[model samples]
Target: MQFLGAINFSLPLLASATETADSSMVLAAVLLSLVVIYLASKVGGELSNRFGLPPVLGELVSGVVVGVSVLHLLVFSEGGTDSNLIITFLQGTAGLSPDAAAGVFAAQSEVISVLAELGVIILLFEIGLESNLKDLMAVGIQASVVAVVGVVVPFTAGTVGLMTLFGIDALPAIFAGAALTATSIGITSKVLSELGRLSSREGQIILGAAVIDDVLGIIVLAVVASLAKDGAVDVSKVVYLIISASGFLLGAIALGNFFNKSFVAIADKLKTRGELVIPAFIFAFVMAYLAAAIQLEAILGAFAAGLVLEETDKRKELQKQVIPIADMLVPIFFVTVGAKTDLGVLNPAIPSNREGLIMATFLILVAIFGKVITGFVVFGQPGINRLAIGVGMIPRGEVGLVFLGIGSSIGILSKPLEAAIIMMVILTTFLAPPLLRIVFPDSEAVGVASELILNTSGTPLAVESPTAINSKSNDAANPEATPDGH
Candidate 1:
């Protein structure tokens, strides 16, 4: 009788186990999601090319499609969609219980985090490689003014707007505004390159301003993070971060200069099969690691590394090699960012006491308006519209997403607030390219200045060659020489 009872109990338990296993169908959904992401990216890339928009815009849009805000295809929600099949399967294979799944997910996220970091590093490095230091110097004053105005106006406006309109507390409001300070150099560079304006005076100014903006944004994010955690600003920490950042920049410049000379010397000495390429990559990785160890942003080191090698003959070859890797990994970073955002939290059904929608709108407007107004501060420049320059600087891209992720991870932003910030990021990124194309229409005649020639006062010196002057005079006198030069 006892044996019969044991068998009866075992049968029900086994049946219950089978039902539970069937319910945990998250693995299938995850595989399907990845496939969708890949297909969407390819299609998006083609469409972007056809439309003359940056391929990134299309990729981001594709992410939105698979994101929680849209078809609910990829994101795994608790008790909602069965989109976590792959995660579940992996967890099961690893012998992780449901309790351990969170840990596994966290670990997986860390890997994604590293790849995303590498993508941005390479992106910034590429920017540094292409940058004209002299051009940046030429526009330094104007760029500084614009960047300052852009940062201050948006930060002030966002803070006030959030406080008044949404009744959010001071810290959150500050954070919301701080998030908007990040400007995406990558997107702007791509747009300018596409429009054939990258070498133009306006493009140079925008690029210079963006570099400053990035540095400032990092400082601001650090401050906000500290404030949100402690409820009071740590002046020492702020100073430390500033000092560290400054030191890193100076050190990178010195070290990079030395390394470049030595590297070139070594490459010249040893003309082996692939010695140069291997060393270059190793240098990049080591600098990146060192920067992290020093508590400075790794991308800064990478950028400096690129700058060190900029004048070298091998620069173009290195860029070509690095760009492919960046292209493959960068999208993964962005898509993961999209995936991490839980859009369902933004649904109005949630009884959260926070005014998410209004706050989000306010922050987004502040972000757009802040950058837009900075364009008007171009400082007596002519031949380019100021509004266009400002608009080009509006997109926040990877940097803003990084800030949002950090904030969410540390509890500075609740889930709904995080979702709202991601929305703002996507909106600004999506709008920038089309807006830029519309305002700065393509023109073959307007070529960007090839080199930055600056006077003692840090102004762009108007260097006029005798030949150019004579040619202009000749064109005025003879119609044939003009070629519509006017």
Candidate 2:
């Protein structure tokens, strides 16, 4: 009896030890993933800069190089980690058993995904800090028009064209159309900042319009998603989304001054090292949570928080403090976006993929032309780079993927349709940075000067090329800078 009791106790101890080791391996996996992500971001960014393109493009390309499409250094759970180098390394060197490998990869992927979400939140918040709320307001009407046109044009054309040309069903066509409406504000804003035009007249209009486009896109997504799920539109749910999104943005701005003062007061009382930024982040996170609770994107809340806080006396100091944190987190978002994309859909050799390739060509044209026309519709901005404004709205990036994921989950999209949307997103995303540079050639000469850093006076300063800054001081000196100086 005593020998049996001893055996039982040892079994429990062995199980507990195994659990502990698995936990440690998860952390190690996350750490190694970060190492790979950081290296990819930096190397890609540097090479992009060298080639006279935005560093963001480089980061994305680097992500592709390391992701499932290429080296398989960074992959997710969706396609399985059978070919993932990181998982293989863990199995080989960390003594991770085959049984535990799947669980570890899943946990690791979830952690990275969460971190990437946080990275975008920080990126939006930082953009808001750099933007002037009043300027955004000034361009509100023109922006509203642009946004409406952007949504209506592509959505109508894409939906109608698909049904007519490809003989697709109404529901799947609508889903694809809806995907074209949202401009990925995160991607466009970063490129604008990099080009030193974030405060320009056209830039303000694009920013204001993009924000509106996001709200509209979300509402469309909700309606279509409801329809896809139940085969009928939920009228009340659509109403709630519209009202809630509009109210959240308006309410946040209305309450800005009060919240700004309260934030500053809280910062004043604290003598701790991170007194300013810590409180600021707390407010941002709370606002983000509230936005999500209302069925809006969390990044919108962070952006709203940044807009409110920008009115405070501590704006510059807050920007300075937030930079380092953004540097660490934001690349995770960008690189993860790049890594998640599977470029295998582009190949035309496979008989099944040939249809997707043809359909993708059509979607690409519609996506580009639909957005490009929105710029021409903007009234009263004389000599404005209409092309840039339209081009700015082109890249669908992560937002397009969300639509694709939902449609795929519901089994609404056929194979060719799904691949077509993916191709549209990939091409538009990769094309925007270089296209922005092409349209704004003057800005390209002084693009490096656009990166913001702190001077001795504790105010944000833009370094410039001697000749370029002389002729374009106003635009070059625009205070809206990106985190990590990209």
The segments of candidate 2 whose C-alpha lies over 4 angstroms from its true place after superposition are: 1-21, 444-486
By summed lDDT, the worst window of 10 consecutive residues in model 2 runs over 1-10
C-alpha local distance difference test of each model:
0.61, 0.81
Per-residue lDDT of model 1, residues 187-240, tens digit only: 676556545455456777788787667667767877898888887788887788
Highest TM-score against the true fold, candidate: 2
Candidate topping lDDT:
2
> How far is each candidate from the true structure, as Cα RMSD in Å?
11.9, 8.6
- Which digits, one per residue and each the tens of the lDDT, describe model 2 over residues 119-199? 888888888887878879988999999999999999999999899999999999999998888788888888777766676
Model 2 deviation from the true structure expressed as Cα RMSD, one decimal place: 8.6
TM-score of decoy 2: 0.90
